[model samples]
Target chain A: MSTPIYNRVALIGLGLIAGSMAWAMKRGGVAGEIVGYARSEETRDTVRKLGFCDRVEDSAAAACEGADLVVLAVPVGAMGGVAQEIAPVLADGCTVTDVGSVKRDVIDHVAPHLPDNVHFVPAHPLAGTEHSGPNAGFAELFDNKWTIIVPVPGADRDAVARLTSFWQALGANTDEMDPEHHDLVLAVTSHTPHLIAYTMVGVADDLGRVTDSEVIKYSAAGFRDFTRIAASDPTMWRDVFLTNKDATLEILGRFTEELFALQRAIRTGDGDHLFDYFTRTRAIRRGIIEAGQDTDAPDFGRAQKK
Target chain B: MSTPIYNRVALIGLGLIAGSMAWAMKRGGVAGEIVGYARSEETRDTVRKLGFCDRVEDSAAAACEGADLVVLAVPVGAMGGVAQEIAPVLADGCTVTDVGSVKRDVIDHVAPHLPDNVHFVPAHPLAGTEHSGPNAGFAELFDNKWTIIVPVPGADRDAVARLTSFWQALGANTDEMDPEHHDLVLAVTSHTPHLIAYTMVGVADDLGRVTDSEVIKYSAAGFRDFTRIAASDPTMWRDVFLTNKDATLEILGRFTEELFALQRAIRTGDGDHLFDYFTRTRAIRRGIIEAGQDTDAPDFGRAQKK
Candidate 1:
């Protein structure tokens, strides 16, 4: 913990990312006073009970009033509406940023509503767990994770620098990327992978060859990984697919093409192709471990619980 | 450590499963003298340096001489040839088993070559890291894991009991399933899932929108999990797909059907369908955790490396 980066920080939509940001900000002394609001009363009650913020607000507009930094941590589909509600109340010179997974969609939806006095910088933090809601927040959720900052053209440099420093203080490594590139990169890295996992898990469920009980019981083989990825927050993912349609479908089309080729190889007993393909992918996993993004311990270093 | 189950145990291939079995058996006191062999001199040297086995033999036959148990831990494609080599030398009444992912193929390929005096019991342990070769083995690999024992009809009861006890001592819970059912179950849980993960990782590598460096750098989201599965032994995986073609293709067909449906829903903006499918998958994950096959830790309990 150190000197505060912002005097007051208000978080709109107290879910996993927002709640986690609150805990991480407090842990790093990045904000003096924190206030949070969620659309659902149940979520609000949960946030209040958890005490993630110094104060809880009932509305988004109330949360943003007089705050130096206001984070729009809502679902992508809801960002425009939330931005509309907060636009009238945003303090002058307040820096507004969002934590949505999709960047261009959020910028398009949110930029029109924000007042000129407030600096709107967009960010997408590549961090989270399958868990969600208020209880899912942790002080270390953003620790050592990547946060990509996508600033609109002609944006204030000082605001961008301050937000970058704020994210760094909250324990994330920051980098700059254009909104279009960010969407394309994330579609390949996160969005499409998640959809594939969800689809595979659903396939296992529908298959009669392996009963659901057996799939669940013997998941440690490989299916368990897909299940964990597939178990992410439902509404949030739905919104991500709905918002990042072009990039996602483009990646999916490529994915299906690659999948059909591999399927053909399997059917044809082409061991050389399969072996070569499998061997190449292993190098990328090694790169992830070498880059310090992941641990090399077998089974992701997860302790085998008895 | 307790009394040895067998005076001499020979492991035919010094790969991940064989090396782990050797270390685990020694750790749990199931084998008195463990002898191992691999065709690759490099692997043999690695195993010798590691001292996983009491003696390192140059050939499968040399390793199997006078052993009470012989484990064929080679890739599924090579099981029959290895079985033929050792069949002429296997001790009378010795139990010859394998650790291949597919059970029916192993039974069909290896059973005829085995001596009539030897008992053939095919087994597939439902555990492994996405690593291979001698150095990948650890004594704790089988702890809290499931090992499915696929005993052919008319298998000697005494040999089956001894093998069960040996695996139990190696820290695994054991169960028996018919060879066909085991193939079907594993095709769903392990083989098909691995293929899908491999296909997805390959797709990411081939995509022009996302650079390989970016894919590896921001892999923590969900792509990392797929990479881990995709990084598994190429030779071993190729054999699994080739030997278990029928079951794998059956389940894969089902997987494609489900994936296409989800992809259609995404194109048409069916948020409700997406949410419901995602929610249903979450329960399967919960069931896996409850069944003790996997831990409920966020990110599969992998500690965030600093």
Candidate 2:
């Protein structure tokens, strides 16, 4: 492993992304020591038992003490509170970053609370699974995944480079993007799609004509993927929708317009319109496979589950 | 391998489902001889080269000659024409079934044309992948999948029993349902979800702010699964929506109402409403996993893709 990037790294939340980050750092030996904190004592105990970090601290402030790097891995709604709590304890020259999906709101909430000496670079790892909590993490979660870093204006260049290398060491390819664009990109990529999935699953449940047992039994027919996505943590998604409101609403507007047009085509027996739309969407899937973001394997490699 | 379920089995369309059926039949020795036909000579040539069938026939009638079981694996739109073409050649005591997603349409279109001597039992195998064509087939595609059989009123019981055994021999569990309910269940479980996925992918493409490259590169954030579902066969999905128009539109309407409510909840900062909706959807996913229709593996077992 490469030399340690930071003397001490503090992770302020013990959830999926944070736990995975700890595991990835330990596997790559990227930090001299890792300290962790969570709002809940139960989560801290679980993390200690799992040995995800070098030390478990009672509070976020305690975890940040003497650490050269502090990562805010809490939900989007809790970022500001955690930032305010840990701001006083951060060491000089420490780099502060976050793994929140909405960057503009996170930067707005986190930037003012951090001291001038501490470098604030907000980052979002473009990777996750349906599972959450401390035990749901593995070292390979970030391998070959893209972690986008949104650096604020006039931020320290050396600190940004150091954080970039830190993420690189954890098996992710890093890119720099501005906060507003990052939020909009994530709105299109993650936020709206998740909401749509959740909405479809809700509709299926609300329909009394189709029994819940029937939906579950025959879920392989396209609905199963939506269910997988809809199964993501409710609290986290609630925060995402609330924090990224404007961007998510804009994307949802476009999505609703497109959906209405397709619905009209189906009603009018316009096969060509439906066929062309589906055909065009196939190219995007091909592009994703070519970019190595996903696999070309059929069924999303479902056979591997067995 | 078990005993042959039929002396001769004919597959009318040499696409993914039909080709996979041929492979499964060969692996299980469910059919003594498999005859395959497609509207296109290219597909027939590919099927012959892949050896998915024991014999490649020039026409649907030729394929059905002397066959005790004929499977119409064509798109829902093309089922009637193929049924009419092969009606004269279907042998006495032969069983004719289909693997269409929309059962009511398939039954309405094909049942009238079949000869009285033959038994017509409409079946739908609630399984598929985004990929299609003859080359996309595999012997294990049907393993542990559910195949629902919809038998018309006064349909021959013996024919239904034999077809159930055929699907079971191919490693699938079987159930019987009425055609109307089957169409409604599939609309909830498959049709509306697919249309939503297609529309979401289309919206992502239409957005100028998020470039296609960015969308493709960052797709794993829930958009990847939407792309996969949107990449399904254009013709097949088009036919499905057109054939199951009433049920799909009904579900789409319900979906829109639910989506609008959630959108309002987000606008009003109603976290409890959003949280409750998400929480309710999670239970359906859990039920899917418990019912053995989907794996609880995070990311749909995507790590195995690498």
Candidate 3:
């Protein structure tokens, strides 16, 4: 086993990301001691039973004490509160990082609360499943996935490098981007698509003529994929939209404009327009497969699973 | 093997659906002989080499000449011409069916040209993958899926019953619906969702600031799912939008209305509204899982594939 990167590591929230990180850290032997804390007593009990972490702490501040690495894995809206609660107890020269989906707002809320001696690095891992909470995590969740690190300006270079090594050791490829760009890219790639999916599923649910049973039975056609995406954690998504408001709104605007154009083509019976648009989109799917972001297997390989 | 359901079965288009049906029929020994034809000579040549069919004919009429069952497996737009071409050659008392996505349009296009002596019972198997063409077919494609059979007024009851049994033998559950209701149901569960996915992917492709490479790289963050749906056959989707225009347009209107509300909530920083809507959509996903329409495995069991 490799030597530990951090003498001690603290995970502030015991959700899917934190649980997965703990397991991955254990798998790689990358942390000397992993201490976890969650807001709820039930989650703490569950994590303690899971035994992925070295110890479970009852308080966030207690978890951060003497830890050279502290990860804030809470929802975006709750990051600042947790940061404030643990700020005074953090060890000197420690590194504080986050796994929130939105980076700009996280920086705005978390940077001031961290002590000057500690380095604050914000990151978003572009990997997840529809499932959430402690039981949803696995050691291989981040394998071959992209984790974008958004380092703040005037940050200590050594702290950033060490944190990058930590993520790379957890089986994720690492890249750096400015917080604004990171937020904008995530809005396009994650937030907006999720919102659209939620909206479509809601529309299907609200339609009285097409009963829920029929919609559920026929969802394999295409709607089931949307439903999977729409089933993500509601509290997390609420914070995402509220925190990354401008970028998500911007992408949504572009999406609606394009949708209106396609709708008009359908109304006018312009088959060429529809065909060309669809043909162009196929190239993107090919690019995704070529880039190793997803599998080219039919139906995302779900058909083969049967 | 059990007795054949039909003495001879003719497939007019050698695409994914027909190829799969041929394989399923062979697997179940449901037909004594399977004859196939495609508009393109190259497809017919591929089918002959693949040997899924007993024979590959040069013309649709030639394939259907003495067949007891004829499946119009072409695109929705092409069904009318194929029906017209084979009108004179269809054997008396034979059953004709289709695997089109849109039923009302198929019935409108195909029924008028069919011979009165033959029964035209339109059907749609709600199963497919992003991949297309003859080589993409497998016998398991239709296993446990649903096929809705729509019979015209005064259609032969025996013919409908036989067709239903044929689909059941191919490993599908059978249901009957009026043409109009089937169109509306599919619009909610398939067509509108596909259009939205196509539109989202097109929007991402058109963004100048977000490079195609970046979009492709970060697509695992939910955008990849839309890309999969968008990668479906261009001609098939184009025909679907054109033929199911009324029902599709109606659903699209509802989708846009619901989307605007969510957009406004995001703009106004209404977290409760977003949270509630997201929570409500989750129930539909649960229903889909319980109804056996989709897998409950995380990420559609894609992680396990790796």
Number of the top-ranking candidate, with lDDT as the measure: 3
Query: Please, what is the TM-score per model?
Result: 0.98, 0.99, 0.99
Deviation (Å) of B94 in candidate 3: 0.4
Q: Score residue A270 of candidate 2 by CA lDDT.
A: 99
TM-score of the B chain in each candidate versus the native B chain:
0.97, 0.98, 0.99
Report the lDDT of model 1 for residue A164: 98
- CA lDDT, candidate 3, residue A170: 95
RMSD of candidate 2 to the truth, in angstroms, is: 0.9
User: Model 2 chain A: which ten-residue window has the lowest total lDDT?
Assistant: A297-306
Please identify model 3 stretches exceeding 4 Å from their true place.
Answer: none
What would the per-residue lDDT of candidate 2 be over residues B79-153, giving only the tens digit for each residue? 999999999989998999999999999999999999899999999988899999999988888888899999899
TM-score of chain A taken by itself, candidate 2: 0.98
- Across A61-83, the per-residue lDDT of candidate 3 in tens digits comes to 99999999999999999999999
Candidate 1 residues A1-306, lDDT tens each?
588999999999888898889988878888999999888999999888899889998988888899999998988999999999889989999999999999999999999998889999999889889998888877777788899999999899999999999999988999999999999999988999999888888888877666899898888899999998988999999999988989999888888888888888889999899999999899899899898888788887664444
Interface RMSD of 3: 0.8
- lDDT agreement with native, every candidate: 0.89, 0.92, 0.93
- The candidates, ranked best first by DockQ, are 2, 3, 1
